[model samples]
Target chain A: MTSTSLNNTVPAPQSTPSYADIQSIVANDFEVMDKQVFGSLNSKVQLVMSVSQHVINAGGKRMRPLITLLCARMFDDNPSEKAMHLAAITEMLHTATLVHDDVIDESGQRRGKPTANATWDNATAVLVGDYLIARAFNLLVGFQSLPLLQVFSDGTCDIAEGEVLQLQHQHNPAATEEDYLRIIDGKTSRLFMMATQGAAILQDKTEYMTALGDFGQHFGNAFQIIDDVLDYSGDSEVMGKNLGDDLAEGKPTLPTIKALELLKDSDTEGYEQLRIAVQTGKTPNAEQLIELVRSSGSLAYCKQRALEETKLAQDALSTLPDNRYRTGLYQLTELASARLV
Target chain B: MTSTSLNNTVPAPQSTPSYADIQSIVANDFEVMDKQVFGSLNSKVQLVMSVSQHVINAGGKRMRPLITLLCARMFDDNPSEKAMHLAAITEMLHTATLVHDDVIDESGQRRGKPTANATWDNATAVLVGDYLIARAFNLLVGFQSLPLLQVFSDGTCDIAEGEVLQLQHQHNPAATEEDYLRIIDGKTSRLFMMATQGAAILQDKTEYMTALGDFGQHFGNAFQIIDDVLDYSGDSEVMGKNLGDDLAEGKPTLPTIKALELLKDSDTEGYEQLRIAVQTGKTPNAEQLIELVRSSGSLAYCKQRALEETKLAQDALSTLPDNRYRTGLYQLTELASARLV
Candidate 1:
């Protein structure tokens, strides 16, 4: 178990705990919520179960569900099991989006594991993705809480719209930072907000709804911006996807969008090269383009923007009750900004 | 407007009405419901709107909503606008499924119009289909009825499961009638049941739930069976796809499942040819195989099954009121059987 185990012998925090520290604080919830994720996939169809299990098992950090758990504890120390179940449902919804995103991205792997589309066919992946979505809603209805269903359903619509909006902007270099924000807001951040807001709704702590919403939205923005930045500059092995992937797909994330803007003013020839690459999605000179974005100083501007958003997210945490769970959320934003380094 | 308009003169049917006649019986509800289908696609993304509108416009006869409207009117002569809204959501969910289905089938056209996947790419189609689904649940939440949400969510899971189950059985020549029934129940009839049962719930007619379910399941079974049978024998010009499309995809529908069963006992050479064709999805001698199924009399057996299902659906209508609406439901089943002839 090492020093990281979520056991009875807990140490007092000297400072903001690490992301792993936040995870261990909620480790028991995380452990049970992880099982709930797989347990929720109770499809009678064997293929549905297997494919859903595959994608959920190829789990991301379960960050969205973690937000739910932290928010639940923030409101009241010993929250009901609904929050864990809702956290699982949040992750299930996130998994559904990832499965479809992989199909849309035509991705072979995620987090160094073969994606559902790669393991099975697109047809199976698409349908299983659908099952995950339906099952998520099915489980949400079990709470008998219309308010929870409301936020999740509304957020889900935004998620899909964000994805479609991103596709609409694909291969179009005219996309702006505003457009990039809108894209991430839907494709990435909506679920994050849902994660926190869902906990508030579940815990009957609706008074914290606004603060949780702000925290979720800002943190989500910061998290997604960092992720997009990582796509350009981070270690591909650690990221589980190659750098310049967004560029290869012609996705004009903030970094790319800013780089295009910065290059438009400073270097005319460089601007055309990047613009043509973005417009065409033909990245034959991939290394040069990656170098161009890295050298163009847009990453610096994006890093600044990410920090600003993180500060905003952390500020939102101040209005909520002060506890380790809130500290966990604050450290989460810090950890997100750390990825920028 | 001719005698067909829903303006006023909904004539009394002396016998089972025509499909169009039954359609005219609920023409007012159908008109509003049809608009609601397009109206419900409130996506902010232009691409989402365009693709969603494109597919919903290329709609079938709105039969599922028709069933809902009929069920609503049978319970109360004048149903609420909620029923109309619910009916529209039904079609929206149905459209979402069709969009995904086109992507899975790699279909070029549906109802002689370019499908979303054909007009846009699979990524756009898949995501837009996702938007349609999310939007459906989002709208369903407006009803504020837990029971309504329960049925729709559960049915959606079943619908996706059916699709996955069909995919699981694909290219398996050993698939049987039992397997085919299970697949169609999940894929085809589950939504049909939701359509009927959703109306009963909206109209506060829970007492009629079982009968409505039976009507939906049997009619869905009959509708799908006839459609699959048409793949073998119907006119390609009207159906808008080539004959043996399912066989080409290695989809073992009832005709194929039963034909494989019948051929094994009577004609060994014919059986091997059909079996290999299904197993490998290499339908080189397509006409020869189609004729082999026809000669095997699987269509005759399938038609009989369709009639029996149609009968069960009509018998379910008898448990509800005996108004023009119930009459409309009865004639819908009859019209479905007529396609067999």
Candidate 2:
């Protein structure tokens, strides 16, 4: 049940730059750019900035920002200074959404640590989230692109709508695959789309920009589905996450939903019991539940879908000229789907 | 100890139609305009619109949007369809702040009714607030003014920082007036400045736009100070709010902060008791405290400052051309200051 083969493969996914690879190219830039964007949090809003940076520094992949920078680097020889700013901004936006998400979920923990809301109270967390988001726009507006502003704003709206849709389905056992897809697209992928598309916009890659947006969107879907799958399949340390967090929150994630659909009437009662346990926020020793999902091929089903999305993401790269960076982006999609396998 | 004379003479101070009066001319226009702005909430994002309308209809004064529309009407004969859209956007941004404020305060009620957070849940309320803010930008980006987006974005950042300032001071008895003033200016007046200035930008009134922003900021400070006074000195019903709601939340409103500063050593016990009451979030018998504040003339002190700000607001208007709407704006400054007389 604990797939050693899958665990081994996660470290060498085809599409993703290994953490070391990303670091070699952009780590110092990430630090400097983040300081510039967040340094705007000065004497007046220092409290907000201090608390927010503390939260951000805790641990996050910086994947969104990296994707943005890589997308720009792919198109332009020496991507303008605006690329760094946009990269920092997309990360800020993503961070803001996470803080707000913690508040929405009433979550005390995130990424295996105490969330800002848990440590500083909901008011501080909420305000800090707002501050980060406002700062993101502040950085973006410095570039003076109405089209850029429009794209990011539309993305934020989609994110908010996705959050609300997820809220409506809390503890709802009947949450559909379609609903899950839309929610993840809005909540996670839209930001990914904005990040990639914003970079393309900066590079003046008008035609490729739209394609990059699609790529990010599809990659994001695959990324999130794998995340959901890992909620069942991942190691606490390896994933930097606690398993069953989604189920504990009654998230009705794809594997759980699919497993529920696949159950026989007699088995359905047992599944309902597990669902009840999830809804009530009791994990109920769900090893057998994981086995049920794996045995029923529900996990495989999700993997298949994730692979399809990864294909779509890779196909989006065809719009761009051949380059190492483009190949790197193509590899990210392969890496995302490979996580499930 | 109530100033019966000031209360009696309240309506004697202003003879002109205030900004509210000018704004009323286009109140229905705002309704139509809001519909058009929010109508963009597509089928996928309709949840954002429905919940947003619920919160909007929950009864706010529509002050910011009215300022926006009146400013546009004053500066130009044709304020562009874009201006109307931006006006609606301003109102939405203001409403988003209020909803988030209610969530942060954990106030079950707002505007004499249950808040969106209380009526639904914090999650719904938070997402809805984000949606509105995003929607405001979505509307503004259509006008294709990078400068306008910059203004709105900066105001929002200031607002977020201001809220954080207030959060840091909550329940801290030593919070100074300077701290209080800075917070209020950022949280409240900045948006008001942006609202008027954004309108002026549309009319291409560069000099007058800066003046209008100054006018709006000063007037907004006066308006909020008066509102704080009313929170203490006026009828809960007539003011259409819960009396001492600020006290219950331990908010260091003008009256309470002043009252606390004036306390003597023997009054230390009483002050501590009041502080405990504020911190514990219990409904104190505010009658004695109200009398104490009255005797100290803190209410009068705050009102004098309000009027001073109103004068500053009026003087700023001199920089603008003589227009009927501008006259109405000047009258509105007096109306804001006179609210708690």
- Evaluated with TM-score, which candidate comes out highest? 1
Q: Each model's C-alpha lDDT?
A: 0.89, 0.76
Which digits, one per residue and each the tens of the lDDT, describe model 2 over residues B1-341? 12233233234444655555766666666666667545645536555667776787775777777777778877775567766777778877888998899898887777777788888878888888888877777777878887788888889999998899987877766777888898889899999999899988887887776678778889888988888888778888777677677777777777777767776444786677666655665755777666666666678888888888887777777756556666556656766765665
Query: After superposition, which runs of candidate 2 have C-alpha atoms over 4 Å from their true positions?
Result: A1-17, A264-266, A274-285, B1-20, B24-31, B34-43, B265-272, B275-285
Model 1: per-residue lDDT, tens digit, B1-341? 22123212334446556778788877898899988888877777899989888888899888888889888988998888888999999999999999999999999998889999999899999999999999999999999999999999999999999999999999999998998999999989999999999998998989989988998999999999999999999999988889999999999999999998999989999999999999888998999999999999999999999988987776676667666787677677777787777
lDDT (C-alpha) at residue B319 in model 2: 58
DockQ value for model 1: 0.85
Where does candidate 2 clash, by residue pair? A15-A331, A15-A332
Q: How would you encode candidate 1's per-residue C-alpha lDDT over A186-305 as one tens digit per residue?
A: 998899899999999888889988988888899999999999999989999999999899999988889889999999989999999999988988899998999999999999999999
Model 1 spans > 4 angstroms off: A1-16, B1-16
Poorest stretch of ten by lDDT in candidate 2 chain A: A1-10
Global lDDT of model 1: 0.89
lDDT of candidate 2 over A83-147, digit per residue (tens): 87888788888888889988877888777788898888888888888888887877788888877
